[model samples]
Target: MSNITNQSLSEILESINSKKISSLELTQAYIKNIENAKKLNAFVTTTFDQALENAKKFDNKPNNDQLLSGIPLAVKDLFCTENVKTTAGSNILNNFVPSYESTVTKNLWNNGAFLLGKLNCDEFAMGSSNETSFFGNVINPVGDHLVPGGSSGGSSSALAADLTPATIGTDTGGSIRQPASFTGTVGLKPTYGLCSRWGIVAFASSLDQAGPMTKTVNDCSIMLEAMSGFDEKDSTSINKKKESYSKNLKDNIKGLKIGIPKEYRVDNMPKEIDELWEKGKKILKDLGAQLIDISLPHTKYALPTYYIVAPAEASSNLARYDGVRYGYRSQKGKDLIEMYENTRSEGFGDEVKRRILIGTYVLSSGYYDAYYLKAQKVRQLIKKDFDDSFTKVDAILTPSTPSSAFKIGEKTNDPVSMYLNDIFTVPVNLAGLPALSLPAGLDKQGYPLGLQLIGKALDEQKILNIGYAFEKNCGYKNEIKKWWS
Candidate 1:
C-alpha cells in the first residue's frame, strides 16, 4: 500500500469493499498516475473525466457481488473504445474515434470494470518494437531507453510503470508475451476465441486474441474473468461455458509434468538466459514437478511459419482500410486506386506496410500454394509438435524471449531479427494454445527474463493453477525487476 499506484485489481476491489478507497478515488488515482507518468509514453489517450463519471455509479456496489467492480484498467489503442480516440498508434486512424466499443472492452465495462484510457501500441499491432507507433515509442519503465516490446508494448509498459493496474492487449504472434517478458509483468494469451474479437482492430483474425496484462497472476485471473465470454457478434468467439479463471488458483501442481524442449534453446542464446533457464528448471524440479526433455523438432521453423501465416491473415484483415472506409484518405488523387496507394503509403508505418506487402505477396495467385499453403502445413506440423509433446508432458516450458529487453533502437532496423524474438512464442499462437509469461530472474544487464508456460487450448486455468502453485512454493517475493535499479 506504499503508493497504491500499482495496486492489483483484487487489491483495489478489497480496498473498495472495505471502504478504504472509493471507486471514484481509485479512478482519480489511476488518472493521476497516467498524467504523472507521461514520460513512459504508455498511454496515447486518456478518458479521466469520463471514467470518473462512470465510477460514481459503482460507489455503492458491493465489490464481491459485482465482478471487477471498482477496478480500474486501460485499453490497448487497437481496441475500439466508444467516444474515446482509438488510434492504433498510427496516423491512419489519428482522428478516428469509434462509434462502437470493442466486444472485449464492452465486456470489461459490463462487468463493472472502470476504463482509465487508451494505451499506446504498435501501429495496427504489426511490429515487435513499439517504435513503429506513429504516436511515439514507449520507453521501458524498468530500463532507460530500452523498448518495452510490442505490439502490446504500451499495455505492458503502463502496468510496469504503475500507470494502470490492468489492461487489455491482443496477441497474434507473441505480442502479449514478449512485452510482458520485457516489462517483467504477468501476461496471458488465452485460447483463441476465448475473448471476443468484435471491434478489436484486426491484425490477423486467425491468431488475434485479447488477454490481460497485470502485476500478478491473480489480478490477471480477475481481469480475464471480466474480459472473456461468448459473443455472437464475433463469429469466432467460442460458445463455451465460461468458468471462473480464479477457480483453480489454489490447486497444487505436485504431480504435474513440465516439458523442456531442447530445441527451444536456440543456437545463439545469451549465456545468462541459458543459465536462468537451468535455474528455473531446478526450481520447478525441487518443487516436486518432474521435468522431461521433450523434443519439438519444428521449433526452428516457428518463426518462418508465423511470418507467413500472420502476414497472410493480416493482408486480408487490413484490406478493409482501403481509404474508402474509416481510416485515412488522401485528399488529392487522380483515381481510387492511386488514392488508396497514396493514402496508405502516407498513413501506415514502415513495419506495417512491409508486413502488408509480405502478406499480399505470399497470398498472391502465383505464390499462394508455395507460400501460404506451405506455411499452413508447417503450422500444422508445429501444432503437432505440441500435440505430440502433450502425450509426454502436460505443459511446455521455455524462454519467453531469447533475450531480455534490448536497447530501444537495437533490432528496429532488422525486422527479421526482431521477429525471431518470438521464436519460442509463435508456435503457441499458431496452435492457438494458452500461454503465460511469469517473472523468472534477472539477466546479465540486470533486466528481467520471464518464464513461459503454455497449456493446451482452453486449458488456461490449468496454466494459471501451475503458476499460482509455483508462486506459493518458489518463495518468490513480488520484487521489482532489476532494471529499476
Candidate 2:
C-alpha cells in the first residue's frame, strides 16, 4: 500500500497545497486502496475515471483557497450525485440516476472535493447493521468477520480501511455514530437542519442529517465546514451564518460543563463501555472541564419513539419508488395495481419492507392517534429532556454504543437485538442534537469502543472542541492491521 493512503485528510491536503503531491497522486493512491479492499464491500459504485478527470483538472488549475481542495470523498449512497447511479444500497433504486446533485455533495464539490464513489448502506438506510444492504454487508476493517454498523456502514468501513481519505454519511437514528464506533473511526451527526436534505434518498425525513465520517476529529471539522450551509432548496435547512468550525476548533475547554447522564448506564451494558465512559470523564476533567451527573428522564422512551416516528416518515418518503418512476420495475405484474404491489414486494429488501409495513401500520387511519401521534408527543418529551439537560451543561458524555462490533450474522436473526445496538445513540437523533463519536479505547476482544460527546443544537463547535481535546489525551489509536487485502 502507498504511504499516501496512511495520511490523514488534513495531512494529504497540506501536501497537495504545498505542491508536494498532486491531486492525481492522492486520488490514485485511494483508488488503489479501494481496489485492494474489495473484500470489505464498502463501495457500491466506484467512479475512478471521473475522479481521475477531476483530479487532473484540479492539478491543472488548483484552487488552494477551497476548504476541501482537490479532495476525493466517497459518500453514502443515499446522497444523489448528478448523473451517477445512486442505489441507496437497495435493489429498488438499483438503476436510479439523478440529474441533479444533493445539496450536501454539491457543497463539497463547490469547495473542491470530487466524488470518489458511492458507498453501500442499509437498504434505504433502514438497518442497524450493514447486513441489510442489498449490495452486500460492509465488513469492518478492524476485524474480518465483524459487521460494520449501519446504515452508514460502508462510509465507516471505507474510511477505516483508508479506501477514501474521508467520507460522509447520513444519520437517521444512530446510523453514523454507531458505525463509527464499530469501525474505530470518527463520525459526527450534526444538528438537524445543519446539513440540507435536498436530493438525498430519504429514509426518515425528520431525522436524516448528513455529517462527516473521517479518520480524526480535525478532518471532521474541515469536512463539516465544507459540507454544511443553508440551502433554500431544502425547507428544513437552517439558514444561519456559515461557521468556521475548523478555524474555531480549540482544545482549551477550561470551564465548560459536560453532563454525564445517569440514564446512559443501561442494564447489561458491558463493563468495558462503562470503563470507557469513566475514562472519557477523566479526560474531560483533566482538561479542566466540569462533569455533572444529569438526568435525561425521557431517555428510555427514545428507542420506541424513534421506531415509530422514523418508519412513519419512511413509509411516506418511500412511496415514490413504485416502478412507475425511474427505478426497478416488476415485469411479473400484468396491471397497474398489481404492478405497484409486485414492484415494491420484489424491489425492497426485507428490512426496508419491514419498516414500510411498520410505518404504514402506524400511520393508518385507526392507529394514527394510538401510535404515530403518540410517538410524536413522546418525541417532544425526548427533545425536552435534552433541552432541560443543556440548561445545566454545555455538553453530554456517554458511550457511543452498548457494545463493540459484532460478527456479521450475530444479531441478524434477532432484529430487536440489532436495534438495541443503537440504545446509547438514538436519543441524540430523537432530540435532533449534534453528537460526535470518538474511538476512546479497545475492548477485551481487541475491538474498538467509542465515547460520544453530544452538544446543544448548532453547538457542534463546542463538542468538536471537547472531542479534539479528548482525542489529544485519550491515547486511543486505531492499530488496525490490513488483513482485508
Candidate 3:
C-alpha cells in the first residue's frame, strides 16, 4: 500500500477506476506518509480526519466521468478554502478561514476531487525561498539542508515527497517553475487569465496565476483541466471554452519551431544549467523541432521591471489587512490609528514588510511615474519581445533556473542575490504567457536541473505537448530518495 503512493496521479486514478484500489485506501496511504514525514514541514494544516471522511464518501459514490474522481489533492495555502484555515503564509491571515470556497477549488470538488490539506508558502507569496514562510522553511525533499523553491515550496515539497499525488500552486514570477526545477518535478504557469484568481489570496494580482505541479507532464495536463475555467467573479478570467489538455496530448512536434533566446545565457550561470539548456535543444532537434536562435532584448529589464510592478501591486492588495476586519489584531494599541499600525507591524514577516515598504515607495505620488509607471512600460516591451519571437517560433526554450537549489540560508542575507534566482523565470510572468518547467538533468551535486518551454497566451496545450515529448525522450528520472520519511 505504501508503494501505491509512489505511483503518479494518473496511475492512482486508473487504480481507483479499475477497482484495484478504493479511494479510502489511497487516502489512508497518503495520511500515513504525511504522518511519517513531519520533518519536511510541508503541510501548514492537515485535514486528515476530513480527508478520510471525504475519501469514504468518494469510494461509496464513485463517478468515472469526473476527471479527478476520489483524488485527494493538497493545494498551496494561498487559496481560500471554506472552513479551513487559509493563511497566506503570513501571520496577518493566520486565523482567517473563508466561509466561502475559492472558485478554483470549488471546480475541483465539483469534478470530484477533495482536499487533503493546505500546504505552506512564502508570506504573501513574496520570497524566493520557503524561508519567508511564517510557519518556517519547508525542507526540500531532494536534500536535507536544501531550500525548496519559494512561494510554492510547500506544494513542490509535498508533491516531490509524495505527500500528495499532485498539487496546485500559485505562481507570481517563478514560484511554481523554480521550485519544480529544484525538486525534479513538472510545474506549469498558465496564461495569466486562463485560471481564475477570485479565491486566492492576492500576491501581485496581475502577475499571480494558479497552476498545477505534478510528477509527470500527463498528470499536469489532467490536473490543469480540473483546476482551470472561466469565472464571472474574476475580472481577469478568460471566457474561452475548457480544453481537454490530457485527451488531446500528443508528442507530434516534428516540425514545431522552438526559439532559443541568446539573452537567456546570463552571466555567472552554472555550467550544468547551460549544459541542460544545450541538451534540451538537442532533444527537441532530435524530435524534429526546429531550433531557431532568437533575441529578446528586453530580457535584461524583466527582473527589475517585475520587482517594481509586483511590489506595487502587493502594497495595494495587502492594505486590507489592517486588523480592523479579520485576521491578526494588536490588542495593545491605545487608539484606532495605533491599532492599525500595530496590527500590520506585528502581523507581517520581515520579507512581507520589506516588499510592502518597497511597494509603497514605488507607488507613492512622488515616485509612481519614475518607478511603477516605467516598469509597466517595460513590461509591455517584455511582452512584445515574446510576441516578436512567437512570430517566428511556436515556443521558446531556456534553463528554468540559473543553477540547482541552494542551501536554505545561503542567500537570505542578500536580497539582490535572492532576486536573481528568478531571472530566468520572471520574464514569462511579466509577459502574461504560459510556461512549463520539467527536470532535464542533474548537476554535479546530484541536484536536479530543469528546462523551460514558453508558450504564447492561451497556448498551454502546445507547450504541454512539447514538454510531454521531451519528458518521454529525455531520460531524466527522480533519483531523490525518501530520506525524510
Best by lDDT: 3
TM-score of each: 0.96, 0.99, 0.99
Clashing pairs in 1: none
Model 3 lDDT, full chain set: 0.93
Per-model lDDT: 0.84, 0.93, 0.93
lDDT at residue 141 of model 1 (Cα atoms): 84
Deviation (Å) of 364 in candidate 1: 1.4
lDDT of 2: 0.93
Clashing pairs in 3: none
Q: Output the worst ten-in-a-row residue range by lDDT, candidate 3.
A: 266-275
For candidate 2, the per-residue lDDT at 430 reads: 85
Tell me the deviation in Å of residue 147 in model 3.
0.5
Count of backbone clashes, every candidate in sequence:
0, 0, 0
Cα lDDT tens digits for candidate 3, 34-108: 999899999999998999999999888888789998999999999999999999998998889899899999988
Tens-place lDDT digits, model 2, residues 310-404:
99999999999989868999998788999999999999988888889999999998999999999999989888989999999999999999999
Residues 1-485 of candidate 1: C-alpha lDDT, one tens digit per residue: 56676566677777887888888888888787777777888889888877888788778555547677777788899999888888889998998989999988888887878688898999999877798999999988877688999999999898888778788799988889999988888899999999999998888899999999887889888888889999999888899998898754664677789999989888888988888778778877876789989989988888898889888888787777777768789786799889988898888888889999999999988999999999999989989989999888888788889999889899977888988888888889899999998877777677878889999889888889877766555554345542432
